[model samples]
Target: MREINNNEYHQWIKETKEIIDKFPERKKSFKTSSKIPVERLYLPSEITNSYLEKLNFPGEYPFTRGIQPTMYRGRLWSMRQYAGFSSAEESNKRYKYLLEQGQTGLSIAFDLPTQIGYDSDDPRAKGEVGKVGVAIDSLKDMEILFDAIPLDKVSTSMTINAPAAILLAMYIVVAEKQGVSADKLSGTIQNDILKEYIARGTYIFPPKPSMRLITDIFKYCSKNMPKWNTISISGYHIREAGSTAVQEIAFTIGNAIAYVESALETGLEIDEFAPRLAFFFNSHNNFFEEIAKFRAARRIWAKVMKERFNAKKKKSLQLRFHTQTAGSTLTAQQPDNNIVRVTLQALAAILGGTQSLHTNSRDEALALPTEESARIALRTQQIIAYESGVTDTVDPLGGSYYIEELTDRIEKEVEKYLQKIDELGGAVKAIEEGYIQREIHKAAYDYQQDIERKQQWIIGLNAFAIENEKMPEIHRVDPIVAQEQEQKLLELKATRDNYAVTSTLKALKEAAKTDKNLMPYIIDAVKVYATLGEITNVLRDVFGEYQPS
Candidate 1:
């Protein structure tokens, strides 16, 4: 490729301006998150040497374009649709349906009760069991979860934190029951507890103990379950909670660095668990900005792992991520328009070279998606993969002058955030000081104000006025699903060996009090049918709960 010099760039910019000047009546406006005006277009003159070096070839230093030579050509991105609700049986059926419909992998979503380390029968879980997702109280529910699915054949992703270690142990036990060894099973557990304290608000233990749990998983998975992604350092939730694209990238990388530091402190080698480190990002509506964010993230992580941490393995430096279309972008007004929004966001994720993708249902703003809506969302990905010829080439937008410039801009912005976070003593201290949370809140509030003031246009929301129309039926969780899950938990508790349960729980508490690895004790607890609440309560007694400052 021929590189443009300063003279040629200036000439091109002048000619472009001349063409724009010919159309005197024409006007253009650039829109950003906070109603910042954008120029009509960007030229090579707008790009600098710093950006040129940053946007180098894929598989080379600073992988701003992509990480692989073949990318999607070698293998299509993993189509992981997030599903789980009501009961294990119900979720299992849904999984089968998704697999039959050509989903490449499974991503599990747990209910609120399960997320915060409560069993279905716990008093804290009353009226909430199986409300948002499936209720997994013990290994029995996990068994029901993967009853028909072959653990060795398909990869599964679980969205859980706080008690993520316990849940991961239960999953391992279930895989073993299916005759699959730990090494053969592949999947990811969203064990990012730092994000919980920063944005999602599902944390149970304090940050110190939470980091220990995270590090234990890293150590455990590195030795055994090599195929599994120990933790998906997530920025999707952080963005959904209202952070700018720059902040999202910064905070996600910060959290990942914290995990690496913790593992190193535990005496684990950098390359040992680093190869399995994966990321989850949100693909918001800003097409170019979102694309630039993903590209910048890859480049930034590669530099951090290789230069800062001196990681040797190529896999350790490669930043593989899963992208989920932005749910927060969906509007309740003119809900059908969300389909178009999701399609554009999904396309950006594909073009940005995500390893996996999840398209949100259009009706998500209204409620949890109905069966029909979820299928439509899945089909959006299918249509993009098969119908839209965008995936024919790798990093289709790699050489664009505008995209390269934006990628450089995003990288610099994210670096600024990292510096600020480092000054605040890393992610944990930043979270405690309310720096990250307050930044996200300010961004969210500013965006909302712009929408209300008509400075930003959200079709059918702040721009185009519409008359009353019939609304689609929203799906609601059956109230009795909670009762049924609670009864199941009770039955399991009644029939399980009481002595084994008590002894396992006691051992878990003792381990929590000491510096021992919690996974072994957790596995013992799950094997003996100790309920989720029982195990968590033991840890709570030793570690105590975290009250947000």
Candidate 2:
């Protein structure tokens, strides 16, 4: 395609508007999810930068096009559906079901107790075991979770932070039991504790101690697990907590920078660790804006690594991320409509060049998704990859005039936020001083206000709402799951070697006090069937809990 000159660009816009003046526009307000105005028409004149400077070829520097040269042509992005619930046995059933239904990889979601480092039988874990996700108290449960699944064949992603290292250790030990070596294993750990502080409240330890634990994993993985993604710096939770798309990218990139600096300060080189760094983002309802957001994120991150940190490796500069459709957008009212909502969001993610995607189920708003609904969600990605012609091309919408303009716009806005965060002494200090949190709160408040004022419409929410709509039969977990999990934990404790557990905990505590990497100790404890709670409790004893004022 040839570039339109100044005169041609002006004439095209002028001629286009004259035809548009005859027909009345639908609404006076046309904005993206980030509240950026959408012009009636986008002209080439609006894009001042040359294609070489901003829109490089796929797999090139400042990768606005995409990270992979062939992309879906070489291989389609992994259809990794996030599924885990109830006892590990039940969740294992779901995993096997999903794999049989054509899911390419597995994503594990732990219940609140497992996520926060509590055993099933602990007083703090009562009633909550297996309520939100699969409950894995020890290697005993982890074994059941992946019972029939081949660790070497399947790539798993664990959505656990704060206690991510402990869970990763358990996974490694589980793989070893499967006769798969640690270096052959592949997976992602959402070790993004900074976002836990900024938006999500799942944090257990102080930020400083958490950073130490995170860097330790980075150092350990660089030598041990070459195929593993050590940390999935997440923007999904931040957006779910009510942030604009710009804030999502800005804050996520800020957190990534902090992690890189921490690793560098720990004597790990930029190139060695940066290549393994991955990201997680949210795919929301706004279609084109979401696509532009992903493109902008890739471009911005590539520049940040290469220019800001002097990272010479091409893989180190690439921003490979997994995307999950917006859970916050799903509504209990007319839940069936969520399928269409998820399809659009998933499409946006694919168009945005995500490495993997998790589409939210239609029934997710009511409860945990049922087996049938989860199958439907996985099929959505399958249809997009095989049936839809969009995957035939890489960055399919890269050359669109509006998309290009929007990409540049989002990049500039993200840079502005990053600049402000840097001034506030980077992501960690900004989060500590409540700057990031306050900004997200304000954005969320304004979004809610817009809905209340009917300035923005959500189907079945603010507009086209119905009365006495019969609710869909939602999936419900068995009430016995908690008690069953607790009983299992008690039995494991009674059967395991108590002395080996105590000595391992003592060694872990001693290592936590120093600069030693705790992965080996944690793996040893997991090998002896030590519970997740016991291992985390040792760290708590050494580092103490974080009490936010």
Candidate 3:
């Protein structure tokens, strides 16, 4: 395409106005949530000469268009619905139901006890077992959780942070029982501990030991579980915790740099572990901004890998991510309004070229989604993929003048943030100093002020709310779920070989003391049916817990 001359540019604008004068007059002013003004029409004159270079062909350098050449034309994005609740048997039934309904992948959500490394029978875990998600205490529960599902046939993602390694070990042992080799398994573990310290608050060990555990997984998976994503550096929680799109990617990139530096310090090659690296992000309401955010993130990560890290592999430069619609955007006042919010958010994710996606259910703000709501959520993804024509081309909005300009602006802002983080001695030191937390807090506070002042409207939440809005049916966990899970743990402890459990835990504790990788030892303990709490307790004794100052 050629740029228009100055005379032609002005003539085109005049002709556009003359044509629009025939229509009824109405107000056409609009602006994005980020305050970027909306222009009536875009012309080639508004774009820079180097615009083509920035929006290069898909599957090429920078990857502003997309990581893949064909994008969704070659394959549709995986529809992975995040679901887990009550007992393993109940969650398994939901998984089977979702798969039968055309969901392509599985994402597990662990209960509070499971995520914080406590067994169902623990005194501290009382009244919380299986309330939020599935409660998996040992291999027995893991086996039942994946009962009839073939591990090699589907990809799974586990949302566990502090005790991610133990949960992964249980998954590996589960595959082994199914005659599937570790190399044959493909999945992701949310093993990102940095975000936990910065936002989520699920961290267990202190900074140094936590990095060791993460890097250990990187090393072990690089050799044994080649198909597995060792860690999913997450920006989703940051956005949910109240960050602008720019801060979400910038802070996420800062953390990625820290992980790469740590791995290199351990004598690992950049390409060896970088290719298996994956990311998670949230797709929020701002439609065009969200699309531009994803585009800018890919380009920024590509340059960071090639220029900063000196990465040589093409796969190492690609920014493959899983996107979930923002849970914070769901409104409980008029629950049906959430479905429209999710639809728009899901469309933004699809246009942005996410590798996989999860659409939040309408009733999620109240409780776990019932089977009907969950099915509606999955159908949302299917409708966009099949019924909507947006997926027919790679980066359907790649060349729009507004989208390109927004993408460039977002990249520049994110670079400014990255530079500040570097000046503060990288992500870890900045996090330790509470710099990241303070920034997120300020953004969150400002957003809340906007809602209260009516500067922003959330439809049913602040603007269009009504009285006596009938509630939708919500899924509730049985009160007996905790008691049943606790009984199961007791039976397993009574039946398992206590001597082997003790022997493996002692070896694990000894390994934790030294610099040796703890994955193999952890895997050994998991094989003997050791509980999640018992294994984590051994490490807690050595590494100590993280007490936020």
Best by TM-score: 2
Model 1 misplacement above 4 A: 1-30, 33-37, 50-52
Q: What is the C-alpha lDDT of each candidate?
A: 0.89, 0.92, 0.93
* lDDT tens digits by residue: candidate 2, 198-273: 8888999999999999999998999999999999999999999999999999999999999999999989999999
Off by over 4 Å in 2: 1-34
Model 2 deviation from native, Cα RMSD in Å: 2.0
Candidate 3: which stretches are off by over 4 Å?
1-31, 35-42
Clashing pairs in 1: 30-38
TM-score of each: 0.96, 0.97, 0.96
lDDT of 1 by residue, 1-549 (tens): 999888987788899888977765443353465222345567766778576587667777677778888787788899988989889999999999999999989999899999999888778888888877899988999999999899899999999999899999999999889899999999899999999988899999999999999999988999899999999999999999988898899999999988999999999999899999999999998898888889989999999999899999988989999999999899888899999999999999999999999999989898778888889999999999999998888889986877877887888889999999889998889989999999999998988887888767899888885888678899888889888887887799789999999998998898888889889999999999898889999999998999986
lDDT of 3 at 380: 96
Clashes of each: 1, 0, 0
